[model samples]
Target chain A: MAENREFFNRRLHSLLGVFPIGLFLMQHLVVNHFATYSPEAFNNAAHFMENLPLRVFLEFVLIYIPLLFHAVYGVYIAFTAKNNLRRYGFFRNWMFMLQRATGIITLIFIVWHVWETRLAHAIYGTEVNFDMMATILESTFMFWFYVVGVVAAVFHFANGLWSFFVTWGITVTPRSQKVLTYATLGIFIIFTYMGIASLIAFAY
Target chain B: MAEDHKTIRMIVQRQDEPEAQPYEEEFEIPYRKNMNVISALMEIRRNPVNAKGEQTTPVYWDMGCLEEVCGACSMVINGKAMQSCTALIDQLEQPVRLEPMKTFPVMRDLAVDRSRMFDSLKKVKAWVPIDGTYDLGEGPRMPESKRQWAYELSKCMTCGVCLEACPNVNSNSDFIGPAALSQVRLFNSHPTGSYHKAERMDALLDDGGLQNCGNSQNCVQACPKGIPLTTSIAALNREATLHSFKSFFGSDYHH
Candidate 1:
């Protein structure tokens, strides 16, 4: 029973990283990318997402719950993981270390992000619009912080897809793994561009 | 450091006791045309003298057959975990460095206690279970294709090189490593060994089992036998996932 519990939990952790969490990252980046057009365009897009049916419930169940578990369990995994980059300096070994590093980074970034936008919206009734983000990013420190945070989050998800495939028995062959490495690197670049570009549009 | 044309310079990492601090002793030997690392170690043993010409205790290393088989000659050759018996001197860059694999407890100099791997074999029951007391004739026949694939897996000699290269198998983590995991896939596929398939899968599902694999993939590259370790691990991952589902929903769902 104990064995099965752990097996199920670890699989759940791996699954949650890709599903709503990864999918949500892509959607969130797209929503923010609207700022590249104009303030009104960004405001309209954010407003539409905010007014969705059962928005609060969906966020709580899908996003918050899974994020909480992934963060807590992921933190445990990160701290416990023994990184051996010195002895084994292979590409995948470096990725193993970076994966843990980025998991922690993404956690901190998400917490601060949620506190700034979502919690502020609830507490002060501040409108979650283009101006709010622009004002936040106006600070040089905050601008860089969001930039690093977005990049880290995107990297964690993209590189994690490679592990996801191998872990779940999807990419068994070395050739498949090699192919997926390039594919994930492409994902990282494309998503990172969308994310950083959105942040730049807001900041400047 | 200029290399002498006729001699090979080698640095050996030596530990006097299992719990003692390790130190390096350099030796310059008259290089033969076709000598390997094991033969070099034998030369050092014959002289038992360091580069300073000071007599030292004979360096300890385990070896058998003077070939890659028997898996006894596995050590870190020039910082790479591999069979020292087959490490030809001409192929290695000097000064050649030899060290005991850190994945296991060093019993002396180069000899390490590979009990963890042996224990994992027992945990997964990497064997064909049958009563030897009675005449059990004509075991279940396996096809030539299956035999060829199984023979590839059977080539593993528990060399410990895979564990040495695996970052996931370290001091803090108790990951069973890739060798035993591959053995599980090997045995589980056997005709008669399939009876205890659930038992082996359960062992892999336990702590320090499949969940601990970070999939850094160094094991496949470091394996001396060219075993498809990552492929076996990935296949087991699929099997483990299905095993959990079957257990959770009850076996009746399979029909």
Candidate 2:
């Protein structure tokens, strides 16, 4: 029984990654896209979000707790993992690069996003209203920053999702994996479009 | 049949201990009907004789289920890392070579340490949390679609062949490799296992977890069981994104 603890833990960890991460990407892109419409639309969406009492409560119990546990544990596994990619060369090298690139981008973007939306409001009374976002986008520096951040976020999200599918065994057949990759490509393109639209709306 | 004239010689890299110096040894095994590399090694183990007519120590390696289910018996065969038990001798050229997988620390002739793979599995918490082992009556049922993929991921044997075949797994890096990544997919697919899905996604987002897989996809090509190792990695990437969002809003998003 004790012997299976590690096995069970690994299984749970993989499970924990699927929902919040997957859901986050979709919501982030959509919410940001509200810039394409109007501040009223954005606030309406936010209001709808605010009214979800049980869901909000569940967020603390489910999402936050799991994220902290997984991130900390991820550091541990990564530091201690055995690397063996030197044999064939090219493919492994690229995989490592993408992984690193996406992680860094996602990390930086996440911090900035939190600061811009959550923390800024909490500490400095800086409202993350639609007008503020529009103003921020008007700045050349912020526009490019969001662009890079979104690109990094998109690539990281898609690639990581593809990898996660394989890790979870959803891609057992070569055909199935191929199908999933196509879906990944489709989702990535759509999300990219959404992100760009939001950015342009803010700028204009 | 004129085909009976073909013969093969093998050059094997061998070591007797972790601290011992490595050396090359040669063996010539007669081609037989339905022969595979593991069978050839078994012959060498039985006879303990080399191509030079010198008596030698029996070659040592690791193996479990011969059907590629256990993931043991994985080694570099003819420069490609795979399961020796399934490597058909007939498919190989003459004088085939064998060695322990380079991505891992070699323990002996063809055996390497795979603790890192298991450790990654641990970091991911790849299991359902049953309060206790004592008759936890029926668990939650999973959707048929998820069960299908979960069944597939369960086939992993943690042979470390994927690690050996990957170019990123090396001395300087801490990549957890593909086998463990695939295992993460296996557990995350479960209905009960979904409870910890976010944690697993976070693990991949972290260093040396999924970030280290360069998508060379050699592990998929190298796996004897034909598990879609790369595909699982991709799916996890998407899942991680969703996980990130749910984390941000502090909400219960996934149904």
Candidate 3:
């Protein structure tokens, strides 16, 4: 029984990465891209999300719960696994290390980001609109931090999707894995571009 | 002209006993043509002298089949997990560093307890089952194409090098590592072994099985036999998925 749970836990970790977390990131990038369109559109989208019926419950189930599980389990995996980049400097080995590193950075950024935005808005009932994001991004340090955090998050999700395929038995053959590698790289480029564009929208 | 003299320097990580802390010891041996790491160690063992010209206890290590076949001589040589018998001194940089493979507990000097690997092999049942001691009439023949990969898989000598190179297999984690996972593919492919396929697949679905693999791809590169460990793992993942589906519905579902 214990053994089976461990097996399921690992698969659950991979599944959560693609479903709610990866999907959430993609949805977030698209919604934030509304800022590039107009501040009014961005505010409307944010307002819609914030005012949904059972909004707190939805966030707890769809976002916070899954994110907490993924992040905590990710940290456990990173701590337990050894990094062999110095001896075996294979491309995949380096990717494995980078995945863990980005996970750590993304966790820190997400915690701070959530505390700064969502929690503060919830507790103090602060207006979370276009002006608030623009104000936050106006600071040089905060802007750079968001850029780094976005880049790390994008890479983690993209590279994680590639590993997800292998982990879940979706890409078995070497040829298929190679194709997925290119697809994953394509994802990284596109999502990163979207993330950077969204951040740039705040800068102006 | 004075005859030119040459010597090789090696820094060996040593432990007095299993419970003792590890320490580094330097030894210098007269250079010999085509000397392997094991040969250099033998020279040091014979002399039992430190580079500072002080008397010391003979260094201990494990070896068998002086060739790489037995897998008993695996250790971390110059930051790489490999057979000491195959690691040539000429190819290695000066001050070659030797340490026991950290994936397994250090027994002493350069030897380690590889019982974990053997235990994993048992977990996966990496063998063909037979009815009795008497010879069973000719077993089914394997097709040449399938036989080819099976032959490749059979080359695993239970060397802990793959375990060493793997990031997932470590002290804190209960991961069984790549060797046993590859063995699952090998044994399950056998005609008679296939009879117990469900059992093996179930074992793989257990904890410390295929799920522990993080897809680092180091095991394939670090394997001295080049056993294609990751490919086997990916294949096993597919099989396990199918097995789970079959279990969920019925065995006849796949049939």
- For each candidate, what TM-score against the reference? 0.94, 0.57, 0.94
Model 1: colliding residue pairs: none
* Tens-digit lDDT string for candidate 1 (B1-255): 334368989999999999999999999888888899988999999999998999998889998877687898899988889999899999999999999998899999999999999999998899988877898786789999999999999999999999999877888778889999999999999998887898889888888888888878888878889999999999999888788777777764431
Better of 2 and 3 by lDDT: 3
Give lDDT for model 2.
0.73
lDDT minimum window of 10 residues, candidate 1 chain A = A1-10
Provide interface RMSD per model, one decimal: 1.7, 8.3, 1.4
User: How much is the TM-score of the A chain of model 3?
Assistant: 0.96
True lDDT of residue A183, candidate 1: 100
Per-residue error at B22 for model 1, in Å? Answer: 1.4
Q: lDDT winner among the candidates? A: 3
Q: Model 2, residue A137: displacement in angstroms? A: 37
DockQ (C-alpha based) per candidate is 0.67, 0.11, 0.73
Candidate 3 C-alpha lDDT tens digits along B196-222:
888898888888889999999999999
**What is the DockQ score, from 0 to 1, of model 2?**
0.11
- Docking quality tier of candidate 2? incorrect
What are the per-residue Cα lDDT tens digits for candidate 3 across A20-121? 899989988988988888999998887777788998898888899999999999999989888989999999999999999999999999999999999899
Question: How many residue pairs clash in model 3?
Answer: 0
